[model samples]
Target: MADNQYITIMLQSLHKKEKVLNSIIQINKRQKEELENPSLDPDDFDKTVEEKSELIEQLELLDNGFEKLYEKVREELQTNKELYKDEILQMQGSIRALAEKSMEIQAQEARNKQLMEQKFASVKKQVREIRSSQKVVNQYYKNMMKKGYVEPHFLDNKK
Candidate 1:
């Protein structure tokens, strides 16, 4: 392939990678919003999680494809040093932008992960508190029974 053709292919791959990264970032933002909702439906959350997983898979595929294209571009440039310098420079700029976008997505994902961990911890604490309270209630009932107090049963009068 000609030098120009190699540059074009690299540029296209970079653009596709950027688009996928941007999409994944947007999905992360949406998931964060849903996480913040106290009444978020479980089904909706599941769907969002599934969509995010699919987007991540797509991003991985795009990254692999971009890497292959980048290697080809590098090989072409090294062999044909007489190619258009301006086009090669432009391709470099695009590659840099793609790298920046990927970093942004990664940062967003890290934040989301931290937020999820905090939420999980909070729930675990709540569960522990509930169990402790139940234990205290059970102990109280046992104490009453030791004092010869009989268990009381209540009948609902409402028909």
Candidate 2:
């Protein structure tokens, strides 16, 4: 009876962890979109990152709880595999889904990284152009404002 209850609790925990992973995948997709936006909002992207962090922490907690429960019935479950076959199968499916979601997140984040690098390169080019133009303007001003003693020319009115 106790082992069955433990299996049920473990299944519930796995479901919660899988849900969090799915949410994180969605957030990563949203982040990719934000990066692609012409006018990217840093705050929004940062908020999503913060949200992802919290979810990751929740995942850790879920994992710890799940591990503790599994330890309680580890010997029994291992010996009586057929006893809780249905719950075990469901948990396996949840694990597979989590893995798929994790892969999706990695791919999305890789794309987002490329986009961020491109944006940074663009900003760098603009900064360099502005600085170059500023230097040219300063040089022009210096040349125009340069003061020196001018050679005097005496008028000769001898006819």
How do the predictions measure up, each by TM-score? Answer: 0.73, 0.81
lDDT of 2 by residue, 57-100 (tens): 99899999999998999999889889878888998998888789
Q: In angstroms, give how far residue 99 of model 2 lies from its true place.
A: 1.3
In the range 52-139, model 1's lDDT, one tens digit per residue, is: 8987798788678767766767776787666657767777797788788878888988988887787678778989999999999988
| lDDT per model vs. reference | 0.79, 0.87
Task: State the displacement of the C-alpha of residue 70, model 2, in Å, after optimal TM-score superposition.
Answer: 2.1
- The residue ranges of model 2 lying beyond 4 angstroms of the native Cα positions read 147-159
Worst 10 residues of 2 by lDDT: 142-151
TM-score of 1: 0.73
lDDT of 2: 0.87
**Candidate 2 Cα deviation (angstroms), residue 130:** 2.5
